[model samples]
Target: MIETYVDERDYKLLERDRYTFFVLKRIMGGECKLLLSDHERLILCFTGHPFPVWIWTADDAAEEEMEKAYQLAKENKLLTGEYHFNIKYSLAEYFIRRAAEEGLELKIITNMFAYDCLEPVRPDTESDGGIHCCEMKDLEELVDFMDRFHKELSIDQKDISGYREDAEEFIRSGNMYLWKDEQGHNVASCKYAPDGDMASINLVFTRPEFRRRHYAENLVYQVTMKAKEAGYVPMLYTDADYVASNACYEKIGYVLRGKLCTIG
Candidate 1:
Protein backbone atom coordinates (compact mmCIF):
# COMPACT_ATOMS: atom_id res chain seq x y z
CA MET A 1 0.00 0.00 0.00
CA ILE A 2 1.09 3.63 -0.63
CA GLU A 3 1.74 6.07 2.22
CA THR A 4 3.31 9.50 2.81
CA TYR A 5 6.11 8.53 5.22
CA VAL A 6 6.00 6.01 7.99
CA ASP A 7 9.21 7.04 9.74
CA GLU A 8 13.02 7.03 9.61
CA ARG A 9 12.68 3.36 8.80
CA ASP A 10 11.65 4.33 5.28
CA TYR A 11 14.95 6.12 4.78
CA LYS A 12 16.84 3.09 6.09
CA LEU A 13 15.41 0.98 3.30
CA LEU A 14 16.57 3.54 0.72
CA GLU A 15 20.06 3.70 2.19
CA ARG A 16 20.47 0.01 1.41
CA ASP A 17 20.59 0.93 -2.30
CA ARG A 18 22.01 4.43 -1.95
CA TYR A 19 23.78 4.76 -5.25
CA THR A 20 21.14 3.05 -7.38
CA PHE A 21 18.33 5.11 -5.87
CA PHE A 22 20.29 8.35 -5.77
CA VAL A 23 17.56 10.96 -6.26
CA LEU A 24 15.56 9.66 -3.32
CA LYS A 25 18.15 11.18 -1.01
CA ARG A 26 17.12 14.63 -2.18
CA ILE A 27 13.44 13.90 -1.72
CA MET A 28 14.07 12.57 1.73
CA GLY A 29 15.98 15.71 2.65
CA GLY A 30 14.13 18.33 0.65
CA GLU A 31 10.53 19.39 0.18
CA CYS A 32 8.98 16.23 -1.17
CA LYS A 33 5.24 16.81 -1.72
CA LEU A 34 4.28 13.17 -1.59
CA LEU A 35 6.36 10.01 -1.10
CA LEU A 36 4.65 6.67 -1.70
CA SER A 37 6.55 3.49 -1.07
CA ASP A 38 5.99 -0.10 -0.12
CA HIS A 39 9.62 -0.62 1.00
CA GLU A 40 10.57 -1.98 -2.46
CA ARG A 41 9.18 0.61 -4.85
CA LEU A 42 9.10 4.41 -4.39
CA ILE A 43 7.45 7.39 -5.98
CA LEU A 44 8.46 11.03 -5.31
CA CYS A 45 6.39 13.99 -6.41
CA PHE A 46 7.26 17.67 -6.10
CA THR A 47 5.08 20.40 -4.62
CA GLY A 48 6.20 23.72 -6.15
CA HIS A 49 8.16 22.57 -9.17
CA PRO A 50 7.23 21.41 -12.65
CA PHE A 51 9.56 18.43 -12.46
CA PRO A 52 8.19 14.98 -13.19
CA VAL A 53 7.26 12.36 -10.66
CA TRP A 54 10.29 10.11 -10.09
CA ILE A 55 9.69 6.40 -9.58
CA TRP A 56 12.15 3.71 -8.55
CA THR A 57 11.91 0.00 -7.87
CA ALA A 58 14.38 -2.14 -6.02
CA ASP A 59 16.27 -4.54 -8.28
CA ASP A 60 14.77 -7.46 -6.41
CA ALA A 61 11.28 -6.00 -6.26
CA ALA A 62 8.58 -8.61 -6.75
CA GLU A 63 5.97 -8.50 -9.52
CA GLU A 64 3.30 -7.76 -6.92
CA GLU A 65 5.31 -4.82 -5.71
CA MET A 66 5.59 -3.45 -9.21
CA GLU A 67 1.85 -3.76 -9.77
CA LYS A 68 1.13 -1.95 -6.55
CA ALA A 69 3.58 0.76 -7.57
CA TYR A 70 1.87 1.25 -10.91
CA GLN A 71 -1.52 1.32 -9.25
CA LEU A 72 -0.36 3.98 -6.83
CA ALA A 73 0.92 6.10 -9.71
CA LYS A 74 -2.33 5.76 -11.67
CA GLU A 75 -4.44 6.60 -8.64
CA ASN A 76 -2.42 9.79 -8.15
CA LYS A 77 -3.09 11.02 -11.69
CA LEU A 78 0.55 10.49 -12.58
CA LEU A 79 -0.31 8.27 -15.58
CA THR A 80 -2.57 10.63 -17.48
CA GLY A 81 -2.89 14.30 -18.44
CA GLU A 82 0.23 16.44 -19.01
CA TYR A 83 2.17 14.95 -16.11
CA HIS A 84 5.56 13.44 -16.96
CA PHE A 85 7.21 10.43 -15.36
CA ASN A 86 10.86 9.67 -14.80
CA ILE A 87 10.82 5.94 -14.24
CA LYS A 88 13.78 3.79 -13.34
CA TYR A 89 15.37 1.91 -16.23
CA SER A 90 14.79 -1.56 -14.84
CA LEU A 91 11.04 -0.85 -14.75
CA ALA A 92 10.83 1.04 -18.03
CA GLU A 93 9.66 -1.89 -20.14
CA TYR A 94 7.08 -2.90 -17.58
CA PHE A 95 5.59 0.60 -17.37
CA ILE A 96 5.68 1.14 -21.13
CA ARG A 97 3.90 -2.13 -21.77
CA ARG A 98 1.46 -1.50 -18.99
CA ALA A 99 0.73 2.02 -20.21
CA ALA A 100 0.07 0.75 -23.72
CA GLU A 101 -2.13 -2.05 -22.45
CA GLU A 102 -4.09 0.49 -20.45
CA GLY A 103 -4.46 2.88 -23.39
CA LEU A 104 -1.80 5.34 -22.13
CA GLU A 105 1.15 6.65 -24.12
CA LEU A 106 4.70 7.30 -22.95
CA LYS A 107 6.84 8.90 -25.58
CA ILE A 108 10.43 9.67 -24.62
CA ILE A 109 13.17 7.52 -23.10
CA THR A 110 16.43 8.96 -21.73
CA ASN A 111 19.81 7.48 -20.85
CA MET A 112 21.26 8.09 -17.40
CA PHE A 113 25.02 8.44 -17.25
CA ALA A 114 27.35 8.38 -14.26
CA TYR A 115 30.93 9.46 -14.25
CA ASP A 116 32.92 6.23 -13.96
CA CYS A 117 36.35 7.76 -13.62
CA LEU A 118 38.08 9.02 -10.47
CA GLU A 119 38.85 12.23 -12.35
CA PRO A 120 37.57 13.93 -15.45
CA VAL A 121 39.34 13.15 -18.72
CA ARG A 122 39.95 16.83 -19.30
CA PRO A 123 39.38 17.71 -22.91
CA ASP A 124 42.37 19.26 -24.69
CA THR A 125 39.99 21.77 -26.17
CA GLU A 126 40.75 25.34 -25.18
CA SER A 127 38.29 28.18 -24.89
CA ASP A 128 38.65 31.94 -24.73
CA GLY A 129 36.11 31.80 -21.92
CA GLY A 130 36.24 30.93 -18.24
CA ILE A 131 33.70 29.33 -15.92
CA HIS A 132 32.37 31.15 -12.86
CA CYS A 133 29.61 30.71 -10.31
CA CYS A 134 26.35 32.39 -11.24
CA GLU A 135 25.75 35.69 -9.49
CA MET A 136 22.65 37.72 -8.59
CA LYS A 137 23.08 39.87 -11.70
CA ASP A 138 23.01 36.79 -13.89
CA LEU A 139 19.49 35.82 -12.77
CA GLU A 140 17.63 37.36 -15.68
CA GLU A 141 20.04 35.95 -18.25
CA LEU A 142 20.03 32.55 -16.58
CA VAL A 143 16.24 32.47 -16.77
CA ASP A 144 16.44 33.15 -20.49
CA PHE A 145 19.01 30.40 -20.97
CA MET A 146 16.80 28.04 -19.02
CA ASP A 147 13.91 28.84 -21.32
CA ARG A 148 15.97 28.23 -24.44
CA PHE A 149 17.37 25.05 -23.00
CA HIS A 150 13.93 23.51 -22.55
CA LYS A 151 12.47 24.85 -25.78
CA GLU A 152 15.39 23.61 -27.87
CA LEU A 153 14.68 20.08 -26.68
CA SER A 154 10.93 20.42 -27.26
CA ILE A 155 10.48 19.92 -23.51
CA ASP A 156 7.24 20.89 -21.80
CA GLN A 157 7.43 24.41 -20.38
CA LYS A 158 3.90 24.98 -19.12
CA ASP A 159 5.34 25.74 -15.68
CA ILE A 160 8.06 27.99 -17.01
CA SER A 161 6.57 30.99 -15.24
CA GLY A 162 8.15 29.61 -12.13
CA TYR A 163 11.67 29.54 -13.55
CA ARG A 164 12.58 32.83 -11.92
CA GLU A 165 12.32 31.22 -8.52
CA ASP A 166 14.22 28.21 -9.75
CA ALA A 167 17.00 30.37 -11.07
CA GLU A 168 17.21 32.28 -7.81
CA GLU A 169 17.42 29.10 -5.80
CA PHE A 170 20.14 27.75 -8.05
CA ILE A 171 22.18 30.90 -7.74
CA ARG A 172 21.59 31.26 -4.02
CA SER A 173 22.79 27.71 -3.50
CA GLY A 174 25.98 28.49 -5.47
CA ASN A 175 25.46 25.36 -7.55
CA MET A 176 24.94 27.10 -10.89
CA TYR A 177 27.77 28.22 -13.17
CA LEU A 178 28.16 29.95 -16.49
CA TRP A 179 30.94 30.03 -19.04
CA LYS A 180 31.66 33.49 -20.26
CA ASP A 181 33.38 34.05 -23.60
CA GLU A 182 36.39 36.28 -24.15
CA GLN A 183 34.10 39.25 -24.50
CA GLY A 184 32.33 38.25 -21.27
CA HIS A 185 29.24 36.84 -22.95
CA ASN A 186 27.48 33.94 -21.29
CA VAL A 187 28.01 31.18 -23.84
CA ALA A 188 27.17 28.15 -21.79
CA SER A 189 25.65 27.27 -18.42
CA CYS A 190 25.28 24.23 -16.16
CA LYS A 191 24.07 23.37 -12.66
CA TYR A 192 24.45 20.46 -10.24
CA ALA A 193 21.99 19.12 -7.69
CA PRO A 194 23.62 17.00 -5.01
CA ASP A 195 21.84 13.95 -3.63
CA GLY A 196 23.82 12.01 -1.03
CA ASP A 197 27.14 10.99 -2.57
CA MET A 198 25.97 11.67 -6.10
CA ALA A 199 25.74 15.10 -7.72
CA SER A 200 23.43 15.33 -10.71
CA ILE A 201 24.74 17.69 -13.41
CA ASN A 202 21.81 19.12 -15.31
CA LEU A 203 20.34 22.16 -17.09
CA VAL A 204 23.46 22.21 -19.24
CA PHE A 205 23.09 24.31 -22.35
CA THR A 206 25.36 26.19 -24.74
CA ARG A 207 24.08 28.78 -27.15
CA PRO A 208 23.69 27.66 -30.74
CA GLU A 209 26.36 30.05 -31.91
CA PHE A 210 28.74 28.41 -29.42
CA ARG A 211 28.06 24.87 -30.61
CA ARG A 212 30.85 22.69 -32.07
CA ARG A 213 33.42 24.76 -30.17
CA HIS A 214 33.66 22.23 -27.33
CA TYR A 215 32.17 24.80 -24.96
CA ALA A 216 29.62 22.33 -23.57
CA GLU A 217 32.10 19.54 -22.99
CA ASN A 218 34.57 21.89 -21.44
CA LEU A 219 31.96 23.52 -19.25
CA VAL A 220 30.62 20.17 -18.09
CA TYR A 221 34.13 18.95 -17.40
CA GLN A 222 34.69 21.92 -15.12
CA VAL A 223 31.42 21.24 -13.32
CA THR A 224 32.36 17.58 -12.94
CA MET A 225 35.69 18.61 -11.50
CA LYS A 226 33.91 20.86 -9.01
CA ALA A 227 31.61 18.05 -7.95
CA LYS A 228 34.60 15.74 -7.62
CA GLU A 229 36.37 18.28 -5.44
CA ALA A 230 33.37 18.32 -3.13
CA GLY A 231 33.67 14.54 -2.74
CA TYR A 232 30.51 13.70 -4.74
CA VAL A 233 30.29 11.51 -7.84
CA PRO A 234 28.81 13.21 -10.91
CA MET A 235 25.86 11.83 -12.82
CA LEU A 236 23.30 13.01 -15.41
CA TYR A 237 20.49 11.95 -17.72
CA THR A 238 20.40 12.81 -21.39
CA ASP A 239 17.82 12.33 -24.08
CA ALA A 240 18.46 8.99 -25.78
CA ASP A 241 17.88 10.52 -29.21
CA TYR A 242 20.22 13.47 -28.61
CA VAL A 243 23.35 12.03 -30.22
CA ALA A 244 25.62 15.02 -29.79
CA SER A 245 24.83 15.62 -26.11
CA ASN A 246 25.30 11.94 -25.33
CA ALA A 247 28.62 11.93 -27.16
CA CYS A 248 29.72 15.03 -25.27
CA TYR A 249 29.18 13.40 -21.86
CA GLU A 250 30.88 10.22 -23.10
CA LYS A 251 33.89 12.32 -23.96
CA ILE A 252 33.99 13.55 -20.36
CA GLY A 253 34.29 9.98 -18.99
CA TYR A 254 30.59 9.60 -18.23
CA VAL A 255 29.52 6.07 -19.13
CA LEU A 256 26.07 4.68 -19.66
CA ARG A 257 24.76 3.54 -16.30
CA GLY A 258 21.06 3.00 -17.01
CA LYS A 259 18.07 4.90 -18.34
CA LEU A 260 14.82 6.58 -17.39
CA CYS A 261 11.59 6.37 -19.36
CA THR A 262 10.01 9.81 -19.60
CA ILE A 263 6.26 9.72 -20.14
CA GLY A 264 3.99 12.71 -20.50
Candidate 2:
Protein backbone atom coordinates (compact mmCIF):
# COMPACT_ATOMS: atom_id res chain seq x y z
CA MET A 1 0.00 0.00 0.00
CA ILE A 2 1.07 3.59 -0.69
CA GLU A 3 0.65 6.47 1.74
CA THR A 4 1.06 10.21 1.35
CA TYR A 5 2.56 12.52 3.94
CA VAL A 6 2.53 16.31 3.91
CA ASP A 7 3.41 17.08 7.48
CA GLU A 8 6.88 18.33 8.26
CA ARG A 9 7.20 16.20 11.42
CA ASP A 10 7.20 13.04 9.36
CA TYR A 11 10.55 14.11 7.91
CA LYS A 12 12.28 12.59 10.93
CA LEU A 13 11.35 9.17 9.64
CA LEU A 14 13.79 9.80 6.77
CA GLU A 15 16.69 11.25 8.75
CA ARG A 16 18.93 8.20 8.52
CA ASP A 17 18.39 7.71 4.83
CA ARG A 18 20.80 10.00 3.02
CA TYR A 19 19.35 8.96 -0.32
CA THR A 20 16.15 10.72 0.71
CA PHE A 21 17.85 13.65 2.39
CA PHE A 22 17.34 16.22 -0.38
CA VAL A 23 13.71 15.36 -0.89
CA LEU A 24 12.97 15.25 2.81
CA LYS A 25 14.61 18.59 3.27
CA ARG A 26 12.48 20.10 0.54
CA ILE A 27 9.37 18.54 2.01
CA MET A 28 10.15 19.98 5.42
CA GLY A 29 10.53 23.36 3.80
CA GLY A 30 7.05 22.98 2.25
CA GLU A 31 8.52 22.70 -1.22
CA CYS A 32 7.15 19.24 -1.86
CA LYS A 33 5.00 16.31 -0.73
CA LEU A 34 6.08 12.78 0.15
CA LEU A 35 4.60 9.50 -1.01
CA LEU A 36 5.73 6.35 0.71
CA SER A 37 5.15 2.63 0.40
CA ASP A 38 5.86 -0.24 2.75
CA HIS A 39 6.49 2.07 5.68
CA GLU A 40 8.83 4.43 3.84
CA ARG A 41 10.97 1.77 2.16
CA LEU A 42 9.71 3.23 -1.07
CA ILE A 43 9.85 7.02 -1.20
CA LEU A 44 8.73 9.53 -3.78
CA CYS A 45 8.73 13.32 -3.63
CA PHE A 46 6.64 15.53 -5.87
CA THR A 47 7.59 19.20 -6.04
CA GLY A 48 5.25 20.25 -8.86
CA HIS A 49 8.20 21.92 -10.48
CA PRO A 50 10.11 21.36 -13.68
CA PHE A 51 12.97 19.63 -11.94
CA PRO A 52 12.02 15.98 -11.47
CA VAL A 53 10.20 13.41 -9.37
CA TRP A 54 12.74 12.43 -6.71
CA ILE A 55 12.48 8.85 -5.46
CA TRP A 56 14.28 6.17 -3.50
CA THR A 57 13.46 2.58 -2.66
CA ALA A 58 15.03 -0.22 -0.68
CA ASP A 59 17.19 -2.58 -2.67
CA ASP A 60 14.89 -5.49 -1.92
CA ALA A 61 11.59 -3.74 -2.57
CA ALA A 62 9.26 -6.27 -4.09
CA GLU A 63 8.29 -5.75 -7.71
CA GLU A 64 4.63 -5.61 -6.65
CA GLU A 65 5.40 -2.74 -4.31
CA MET A 66 7.11 -0.82 -7.10
CA GLU A 67 4.07 -1.37 -9.33
CA LYS A 68 1.73 -0.22 -6.62
CA ALA A 69 3.78 2.87 -6.00
CA TYR A 70 3.62 3.84 -9.64
CA GLN A 71 -0.06 3.10 -9.73
CA LEU A 72 -0.60 5.31 -6.76
CA ALA A 73 1.30 8.14 -8.42
CA LYS A 74 -0.66 7.61 -11.62
CA GLU A 75 -3.96 7.69 -9.81
CA ASN A 76 -2.92 10.93 -8.13
CA LYS A 77 -2.02 12.39 -11.56
CA LEU A 78 1.64 12.64 -10.57
CA LEU A 79 2.62 10.40 -13.48
CA THR A 80 0.90 12.56 -16.09
CA GLY A 81 3.23 15.50 -15.74
CA GLU A 82 6.10 16.61 -17.94
CA TYR A 83 8.56 16.72 -15.08
CA HIS A 84 11.54 14.38 -15.03
CA PHE A 85 12.37 11.64 -12.56
CA ASN A 86 15.42 11.77 -10.36
CA ILE A 87 15.90 8.35 -8.81
CA LYS A 88 18.28 5.47 -8.32
CA TYR A 89 19.48 4.23 -11.70
CA SER A 90 17.87 0.85 -11.29
CA LEU A 91 14.62 2.41 -10.26
CA ALA A 92 14.85 4.83 -13.15
CA GLU A 93 15.09 1.92 -15.52
CA TYR A 94 12.21 0.20 -13.82
CA PHE A 95 10.06 3.29 -14.09
CA ILE A 96 11.04 3.73 -17.70
CA ARG A 97 9.94 0.21 -18.51
CA ARG A 98 6.71 0.69 -16.63
CA ALA A 99 6.02 4.02 -18.32
CA ALA A 100 6.61 2.41 -21.68
CA GLU A 101 4.03 -0.21 -20.87
CA GLU A 102 1.68 2.62 -20.00
CA GLY A 103 2.38 4.31 -23.35
CA LEU A 104 4.14 7.26 -21.72
CA GLU A 105 7.47 8.53 -22.99
CA LEU A 106 10.41 10.21 -21.33
CA LYS A 107 12.46 12.73 -23.25
CA ILE A 108 15.96 12.30 -21.95
CA ILE A 109 18.01 10.30 -19.48
CA THR A 110 21.17 11.24 -17.63
CA ASN A 111 23.31 9.46 -15.08
CA MET A 112 24.52 11.36 -12.04
CA PHE A 113 26.78 10.85 -9.05
CA ALA A 114 25.79 11.84 -5.52
CA TYR A 115 28.53 12.77 -3.07
CA ASP A 116 28.62 13.70 0.59
CA CYS A 117 31.29 14.82 3.04
CA LEU A 118 31.23 14.64 6.81
CA GLU A 119 34.74 15.95 7.31
CA PRO A 120 36.07 19.47 6.88
CA VAL A 121 36.57 20.37 3.23
CA ARG A 122 40.04 21.57 2.45
CA PRO A 123 40.40 24.55 0.14
CA ASP A 124 43.43 25.32 -1.94
CA THR A 125 45.37 28.03 -0.15
CA GLU A 126 46.38 29.55 -3.45
CA SER A 127 42.79 30.18 -4.48
CA ASP A 128 41.55 31.40 -1.10
CA GLY A 129 42.16 35.17 -1.38
CA GLY A 130 39.55 35.83 -4.05
CA ILE A 131 36.74 33.81 -2.49
CA HIS A 132 34.13 35.78 -0.58
CA CYS A 133 30.40 36.11 -0.02
CA CYS A 134 28.45 37.73 -2.82
CA GLU A 135 27.06 41.16 -2.15
CA MET A 136 24.12 43.06 -3.65
CA LYS A 137 26.64 45.04 -5.68
CA ASP A 138 27.62 41.83 -7.43
CA LEU A 139 24.06 40.98 -8.44
CA GLU A 140 24.30 41.66 -12.17
CA GLU A 141 27.46 39.64 -12.62
CA LEU A 142 25.96 36.81 -10.59
CA VAL A 143 22.85 36.80 -12.72
CA ASP A 144 24.90 36.61 -15.86
CA PHE A 145 26.87 33.70 -14.52
CA MET A 146 23.69 31.90 -13.42
CA ASP A 147 22.10 32.36 -16.80
CA ARG A 148 25.18 31.00 -18.51
CA PHE A 149 25.33 28.12 -16.07
CA HIS A 150 21.75 27.07 -16.71
CA LYS A 151 22.16 27.47 -20.45
CA GLU A 152 25.25 25.29 -20.46
CA LEU A 153 23.37 22.60 -18.59
CA SER A 154 20.44 22.83 -21.06
CA ILE A 155 18.14 23.88 -18.22
CA ASP A 156 15.54 26.48 -19.00
CA GLN A 157 16.97 29.91 -18.33
CA LYS A 158 15.15 32.31 -16.08
CA ASP A 159 15.03 36.02 -16.86
CA ILE A 160 17.64 38.33 -15.41
CA SER A 161 15.16 39.74 -12.90
CA GLY A 162 14.40 36.25 -11.65
CA TYR A 163 18.09 35.49 -11.35
CA ARG A 164 18.60 38.83 -9.67
CA GLU A 165 15.89 38.06 -7.12
CA ASP A 166 17.39 34.68 -6.45
CA ALA A 167 20.86 36.08 -6.15
CA GLU A 168 19.56 38.73 -3.80
CA GLU A 169 17.98 36.09 -1.57
CA PHE A 170 21.16 34.09 -1.56
CA ILE A 171 23.18 37.19 -0.79
CA ARG A 172 20.83 38.22 1.99
CA SER A 173 21.02 34.73 3.42
CA GLY A 174 24.84 34.82 3.08
CA ASN A 175 24.89 31.46 1.35
CA MET A 176 26.22 32.59 -2.02
CA TYR A 177 29.90 33.13 -2.68
CA LEU A 178 31.97 34.16 -5.66
CA TRP A 179 35.60 33.93 -6.57
CA LYS A 180 36.92 37.20 -7.98
CA ASP A 181 40.05 38.14 -9.80
CA GLU A 182 42.49 40.66 -8.36
CA GLN A 183 40.70 43.27 -10.52
CA GLY A 184 37.40 42.26 -8.84
CA HIS A 185 35.83 40.43 -11.76
CA ASN A 186 33.72 37.50 -10.58
CA VAL A 187 35.19 34.32 -12.05
CA ALA A 188 33.40 31.54 -10.22
CA SER A 189 30.51 31.01 -7.83
CA CYS A 190 28.87 28.43 -5.54
CA LYS A 191 26.11 28.21 -2.94
CA TYR A 192 24.84 25.84 -0.26
CA ALA A 193 21.22 25.16 0.70
CA PRO A 194 21.04 24.21 4.35
CA ASP A 195 18.35 21.92 5.74
CA GLY A 196 18.66 20.76 9.33
CA ASP A 197 21.87 18.74 9.58
CA MET A 198 22.31 18.41 5.85
CA ALA A 199 23.25 20.99 3.22
CA SER A 200 23.43 20.55 -0.51
CA ILE A 201 26.05 22.46 -2.50
CA ASN A 202 24.79 23.74 -5.81
CA LEU A 203 25.18 26.36 -8.57
CA VAL A 204 28.93 25.92 -8.90
CA PHE A 205 29.95 27.78 -12.01
CA THR A 206 32.97 29.31 -13.74
CA ARG A 207 33.12 31.55 -16.74
CA PRO A 208 34.53 30.19 -20.00
CA GLU A 209 37.58 32.38 -19.72
CA PHE A 210 38.15 31.05 -16.22
CA ARG A 211 37.83 27.35 -17.03
CA ARG A 212 40.59 24.95 -15.89
CA ARG A 213 41.78 27.45 -13.28
CA HIS A 214 40.43 25.59 -10.22
CA TYR A 215 38.26 28.56 -9.27
CA ALA A 216 35.00 26.55 -9.08
CA GLU A 217 36.68 23.79 -7.11
CA ASN A 218 38.13 26.22 -4.60
CA LEU A 219 34.80 28.03 -4.22
CA VAL A 220 32.95 24.76 -3.63
CA TYR A 221 35.61 23.74 -1.13
CA GLN A 222 35.08 26.97 0.78
CA VAL A 223 31.28 26.53 0.83
CA THR A 224 31.58 22.94 1.95
CA MET A 225 33.97 23.90 4.72
CA LYS A 226 31.60 26.61 5.88
CA ALA A 227 28.71 24.16 5.89
CA LYS A 228 30.75 21.75 8.01
CA GLU A 229 31.66 24.52 10.44
CA ALA A 230 27.95 25.28 10.79
CA GLY A 231 27.32 21.63 11.76
CA TYR A 232 25.76 20.56 8.49
CA VAL A 233 26.81 17.55 6.44
CA PRO A 234 27.66 18.76 2.92
CA MET A 235 26.40 16.89 -0.13
CA LEU A 236 26.33 17.52 -3.88
CA TYR A 237 25.34 15.95 -7.16
CA THR A 238 27.28 15.98 -10.40
CA ASP A 239 26.92 14.56 -13.85
CA ALA A 240 28.57 11.15 -13.90
CA ASP A 241 30.04 11.93 -17.29
CA TYR A 242 31.56 15.21 -16.09
CA VAL A 243 35.07 13.99 -15.29
CA ALA A 244 36.59 17.27 -14.17
CA SER A 245 33.77 18.07 -11.72
CA ASN A 246 33.88 14.57 -10.23
CA ALA A 247 37.64 14.79 -9.82
CA CYS A 248 37.47 18.23 -8.25
CA TYR A 249 34.88 17.20 -5.65
CA GLU A 250 36.80 14.02 -4.83
CA LYS A 251 39.94 16.09 -4.39
CA ILE A 252 38.08 18.15 -1.81
CA GLY A 253 37.09 14.94 0.12
CA TYR A 254 33.58 14.24 -1.19
CA VAL A 255 32.91 10.51 -1.34
CA LEU A 256 30.59 8.89 -3.84
CA ARG A 257 27.48 7.72 -2.00
CA GLY A 258 25.52 6.37 -4.94
CA LYS A 259 24.30 6.82 -8.48
CA LEU A 260 21.25 8.83 -9.49
CA CYS A 261 19.46 9.07 -12.79
CA THR A 262 17.16 11.67 -14.33
CA ILE A 263 14.56 10.83 -16.95
CA GLY A 264 12.82 13.82 -18.52
Backbone collision count in every prediction? Answer: 0, 1
* Per-model lDDT: 0.74, 0.74
Tens digit of lDDT per residue, candidate 1, span 131-189? 98999999999999999988877664644567788899999999899999889999999
For the record, the alpha-carbon RMSD of candidate 1 to the native fold, in angstroms, is 2.6
Cα error, candidate 1, residue 70 (Å): 1.8
- Work out the TM-score per prediction: 0.86, 0.86
Give lDDT for model 2. Answer: 0.74
